[model samples]
Target: MIAPPARPDSLVRQDRFTTDESTADVAVVIVTYRNADSISTLVDSLRSEAAVSSIRVVVVDNNSGDGTASTLAAHDDVIVVAGEVNLGYAGAINVARSRIGATRAVLILNPDCVVQPGCVTALRAALREPGVVAAVPRLHDVDGRLSFSLRREPRLPATLVDAMLGARLPRRPVWASETIRDVAVYDRAHSIEWATGAAMMMSAGALDAVGPWDERFFLYSEETDYFRRLRSHGLVLYVPEARVEHTGGGSGSSQALSDLLTVNKIRYVQKYHARSFVTAFHAVTLFGEAVRCWSSKHRATYRAVARRHEWSNLLRAETPRPTECRDMGSVVIPAHNESRVIARTLDALADLAARGVVEVIVACNGCTDDTARIAAGRPGVRVLDLDVASKTAAMNGADEVAELWPRVYLDADVVITPAAVVDLVTALADGTLLAARPASRYDATGAGHLVRRYYRARSSLPLVRSHLWGAGCYALSEEGHARVGRFPDVVADDVVVDAAFATDEKIVVDTDPVVVLVPRTPAALIAVLSRNYSGNRDAPATTSSTGTLRHVAGTVHGPGTLLDAAVYCLFAALGRRASRRTSARWARDDTSRT
Candidate 1:
């Protein structure tokens, strides 16, 4: 645990104080809500030598029922302002802004955030640049994953595109999240449209010009509206060379809060746009909300809030017009012997395809039954029949039929989730050869989570080479496929094709996972794993003997590395146990059938 900076003043001051002898001029305000557990850490992080020597710290305890006041009282550097009741984020920040006074800059930080060393200095330096109104630091989740802190203000059309079709229509799929793309393209010195309120610094001059956050938005969309206001004044938002760790959703978690977020989003649209814009925005948002409420597990709460808002918006007269764009890519499913689940898969694919992300290609590979005929029965679907047993061969067949068009490969048995295909295709960048779709299991066995983690960890390692590409689902560039000499005819063609490229040239995986029905019977699981192991064993070794030895040793005894060999052995034992059970069940079923 990091320690807080020592207090320079004898006593904590309530009102803003001027220090003529300042090195870097800025003040940071953090608002807390029942965050006593993490307040000390947050205060310490903000009061670190790098932050304290340059900036002031203001801790706003939003009438937290927890012992939040005591936590702030212990920190001498923190000027604790206790609210009478639990004020929402916008209200709390507004209170802090009043005490911030005339500093060169003001930083809005969350209580659960910890600034990386020198982050304040970097943000302040970035703001000093001309035309830059605010500079937000790159924020990472507690697990050191990048948060989508930077973003374009959400428009109704963009929301519809994202909700219905997917990000593929954006032309830059790699920039699905506003923050990651902003960090990648915009330099430490470049500008952006908006950023997350998790950790953002604004110049005092800009704040004075644009004014405070829109208080009407009690929670969400306030920052978005603020950035809009800032842009109106010709001040651009900049992302500087700074990093902050954010513990996601520390303050708001209640169903009430979730409803508030939904309602406030509507309020944001109403506040910013004209009557015409508001009308169209409300229509799309309300429709989307109704669908969301109906489908959500928390239907009672979501529906109640959504219906109320919809009724309120219905009385309004004028509405805004929506933007339109060209739809790209066809979702292509290749099937063989999928009579049981072919209709369901096609149905799900059709719903997604209707979003205009990609066209559906249900290429029937070596199917002697109604798989091809069933697929052809669907409207707007072009079905192709192919007499190929190999997975790679099937893909090749699909490619030949859909020549020059980008295609997404979907397995016959797998169920694609809502917007998953769109998300995958939209996230594709210029150099990305393939985009790996995430897979979720039908059962909540936690195996999918572990598999995802394993894939992510292994993918990051420079030594681990990917040869066994998953045939379940993945998208490939038609040109990129041709460039890479097409998919190889191997047992596990996906892995084989994945290994052909350099690590940097392979398909990138996203968090939006596809749902896969795991083998319910142990025999099926073992068969899949055995086939995978066999494919891996037969594939030529990509790593040298020396590298393999090093990998083994690292698995055995490396700092921070778990005993993976033992773990692998344990999983193998579990597989054996499952196989025995499966065999017994199969024997009993056979006897009954006879």
Candidate 2:
């Protein structure tokens, strides 16, 4: 892994970003509190993505003592604003928005949310559809479990139902229904009433028309109120194909920030409903919460926060949004004695660039053939020739381009599709350290299909550490390469590089197939695997030697291991049978179609 670049003397400064005046189509705002550990990841993701052409990331730090301000200042792309105090979520967002003059849309994201590649693009596309005032992507947890962030607006009766009977009453049965009409389960793609603010994208037009978020309510229900207001104006909220992993609950110290939550809920009801309903609803709900808290021994904590008369003041504090610093990145492709394959790779890249994928910088190393010539012929593809034959040396030499922009290392033999590049860029945009795709090998016998299916299943297991595989066809942001240092000069350079970042950095394997072309022969396969084993031998063991030995023994003898082995054998046998049937069906289909 490459080391992060040195912090600039002074972070970039902007007056204010305006939705009307700004050329950027989207602006992402992250309200952060003590997020020093995760802020860099967020900025890195934004900087490396190519799908989002023009973006401004505003990070509002809520007076965190966690070195968050300095960390945000390190990035050229982020606008870091430090709050005077720990302002609640709404206050911090307002502070951030004060600096953002205008944008086509405002993307409200939690500091911990890691958006998949192309998620923003999908959200932007969804927002463009008529009447969509706001839209949210599907949210997943850290463990990749889906979190149903989309929900219907809470009615007064539903709130009363919950307040009176609690979980016993089937209040909000709309969420429970599994039918297609129930927006939660209808995954194919459709509209919805409201999505969680963990990662919501709202049109600038809608935001301006609705005015600022009601400052009376701080964190929760702020989104609910915003959605309700948008709906009142006859605009619709939607859930798009985009996805984000929300690490929820960043501000509060305990699970029961119940008083603050209750206060906000009361404020929301007061703002939207009639006085009678608000009074009745607030009384019942507060009483219900009081009962629950008393039973759960959380009444004191709730009462203490509510005792503070300045609860409303907590919602109004403002902070400025972080400014985006320019982060330039370069793409480095190391080519060997390839002339034929190099052109195809260059063509695919050119297509990507044409579609606004990424800027390319090709480094042709140890090519005895016309690899340099072919690379130079392509527009925007810079050719770097190295006299040495070593792959590690070629990659190290390519690091020279890192001086200009963050560098992404690419191999010449692999062809990256445009969609794959978009996916990778999107993942990088959301702050993934290293992003890659499974290598799709071509085969006429359908063995490739079977291998891919099995590989995917195995890869999804919790025990599997994906970065153990070498960087077959991968893209690393310049910052990632710099932080990680140069690729280790070894026979298995990729494996060594993977090991370097496996622990600290996020290595994302996008669902898309970025590299088409895998080892075709047994010799090629053995060479790759042997190099990996060699790297593994040289690499520092994460566990103790005793543990390692025990693990190895278990793999050879344990029942779970034995079962997995048996499953693999069964799958292989079944795949052969399935392949024969598929071939026969394909032949019949071809005959019928002809």
Give TM per candidate: 0.46, 0.46
Could you give candidate 2's per-residue lDDT for residues 1-594 as a string of tens digits?
A: 999897653233232222344556678889888888887776666553323446777888888888989887877556778777766677677777777765788888888878777787888888788767777788778897767566665566566556555646333475432111333463756666766778888888877787766443546778778877777665554554687777776664553465556666665665556656765765566565666675553465345333322242333233212212222334567777767677877787785444333567667766788889988888766678888876667777777654444345666766666544544544454354454433333222322443443333333232333343433465565466666686765654555556556443544332234443433333333333344444445555445535433433433335654554444344534544444443221111111111
How does residue 275 of candidate 2 score in lDDT?
51
Report RMSD (Å) for each prediction in the order shown: 21.4, 23.1
Tens-digit per-residue lDDT, 217-284, candidate 1: 55677788888888876656555468889997986676666666666665676555555676576566
Give candidate 2's TM-score: 0.46
Cand. 2 Cα-lDDT: 0.58
Cα-lDDT of candidate 1 = 0.59
What Cα-based lDDT does every candidate model obtain? 0.59, 0.58
